[model samples]
Target: MSTQTPPPVATGAGLAPLVELRGIEVVYDAAILGVADISLTVAPGEIVALLGANGAGKSTTLKATSGLLVADRALVSRGSVLFRGEDITGVAPNLLATRGIVHVLEGRHVFGHLTVEENLRTGTFLRRLGRRETERDLDEIYGYFPRLRTKRKTPAGLTSGGEQQMLAIGRALLTRPELVLLDEPSMGLAPIIVEEIFEIIAGLNRTKGTTFLVAEQNIAVSLRHAHRGYVLDGGKVVLTATAADLRERDDLHEIYLGLASV
Candidate 1:
């Protein structure tokens, strides 16, 4: 195990991490290795980025944390996943969501046939809020993504790619999660839209105190919005540092491409 301690970010210093992965190893179909050994931490109210190229196990790590691996026929074969210091390895994803963790998957997933407002209602099922409370929450989400409000009556499938992405995130917010595991949030979006999405992510972290563990290939934008980051290569963590420190490393692109050592 590595003896290094992660540099602290956010006001939750000295408190137990909101999420912790201790040398976790994931396997798919009980044979194929997904991640060899990966560990990291997310302090409450911090935005931490998981940076890597395609197939670098970024999504696998997020699935492990969110307990969504079972959907992919995957499991944490070794080590542990902790939420606020409580062991929760292999817990059901729905159970995890009720425990204040939610995952926005790599692809912008939405109910194509449902109107935008109807789709957001799905998020309130776990909480079982009354009609008034549900409406208030819906308003809050629309406040975050005004575009969603404009398209509230439109089918999610009719929305643009960026609008769909925003809707996915907005719906997740109605769940009132303490920790959000966001995978490839920038994928397939235009650069301007990516920037807009990340800005909202940062704003949520700042105002709502929502802790985030974001898996992304867009290192530049991820680092710009995140407080700290972990860089993965070939299914293992190769670098962990504060965002500023990582941004200053000129060889970061090379490191991502496997052309240089950390």
Candidate 2:
């Protein structure tokens, strides 16, 4: 990793950020660089987006933050990842979940054989909630994704792509995460379904005070819901701005269309 410090963005609005990654670099197979010199922050109850196209390093950044890098033959070679004021870089993925850092990976990896409700139940494995609390949490999840309630008894693999995405996010909610790392939530879904998923994310941030750092390729939809967004290209952050500022900038079109390099 380079010794040069990353440029600063907004942080600590009278409280520590829910997630902070400072000058982080990741490598795979000891040769290939995944992401380099990445720095960003997510305030409590805020929705942040890592916006980029395919091969733009969005997923690599999310994987580093959630400690899933090693499983992919990658490692955080430099910098730090902090959650709720504690350094958690290189922590095991399962241990990170128990600490309220939940990651909903790309492709909505729900268990195909498990029933819808059972998939949700797997999220509660980290927390020692009693039957009553667990049931209450399940009810709340159904309240958020009513479609899942109707399909509770059905196998997850039989659900539509939109429903599978909902199941992935709902299962993460079952962990009661303080900060959620979501990768590509809008991929391969209809525009209407993407809007619905984003609405649920906004509701969760508004009512539940859950912090989100979402990696997405859908620039239009991601900006609509994000409080702030970082535009990444070739594994480096090209722009960081409030969602409103990013929306108003014309130059971002080049970045999104892969016509510009930072």
Candidate 3:
């Protein structure tokens, strides 16, 4: 069974970016800088990777874009965050989610007590879907992750790590997000699972026209799937390049060694 998904709503090259951060600076607790002077763009239907190691401000950047920083008393004290040409610098996270921006935060955050199906249902909190519509959406998510269907009745906390990751992403899809801000989809998963997740992500971008801004440390795999990448280190963007350029420059290795130079 196939439902007609909408074509990519993001316009052509001349159109504004789906998500743009212009010289944005983030601060934590009152004075600690998380990410500074970082600017990047995720064009419509594009998969863009924010590459860096732990504490490199990747998570901080994603949180800033998705309006999640407010929860931790962090703020984008400078610059701006734009969503499809509109200023959403400090919009509330729930509002952003309702506006077709979903953030799948780092660490699989599925509700422990909820069944797999229930977890998926929570993603539709913003949408007023009839029973048929909601079931159809659930089935669609199952198509992308068959393992989820098999484990649909199981408590989310009982699933394997890879299954939990799939649940996290599948839940996000239930929201029908135009843009998904994904953090560390590959973390804690086996290599085969990582590849599987990325393949599904690529398929979603192609068939559903979902744009992704993924924060990832698995450089080799991420660049393989991303259209473009930005390497961040110490709260700053060190390099921005197309995926092929990044591969050719061997920047992936440099990033691993903390030597990525602009």
Of the candidates shown, which would achieve the greatest TM-score relative to the real structure?
A: 1
TM-score of model number 1: 0.95
What's every prediction's RMSD, in angstroms?
Answer: 5.2, 6.6, 4.5
**Sort by lDDT, top down from the best:** 1, 3, 2
Give each model a TM-score: 0.95, 0.92, 0.93
lDDT of each residue in 1-262, candidate 2, tens digit only: 1122222233324467888889998999999999888998888878888988888899999999888897898999989999888999999988998888888999999999999999999998788789998899999999999999999999999999999999999999899898899999998999889989988897777777788899998887877878789999878888998887887887787887679765
Least well predicted 10-residue stretch by lDDT in candidate 1: 1-10
User: Where does candidate 2 stray beyond 4 Å?
Assistant: 1-14
Candidate ranking (TM-score, best to worst) = 1, 3, 2
**What does the lDDT read for residue 46 in candidate 1?**
87
User: Against the unseen true structure, what C-alpha lDDT does each candidate score?
Assistant: 0.90, 0.87, 0.87
Model 3 lDDT on a 0 to 1 scale:
0.87
Backbone clash pairs for candidate 3 read none
Candidate 2 versus the native: TM-score?
0.92
Question: What lDDT tens digits, residue by residue, belong to model 3 across residues 47-157?
Answer: 888998788899999999999999989999999999989999989999999998999989989998999999999987679898899999999999999999999999999
Candidate that scores best on lDDT: 1
Residue 110, model 1: Cα distance from true site in angstroms: 1.0
The C-alpha local distance difference test score for the whole of candidate 2 amounts to 0.87
Better of 1 and 2 by lDDT: 1
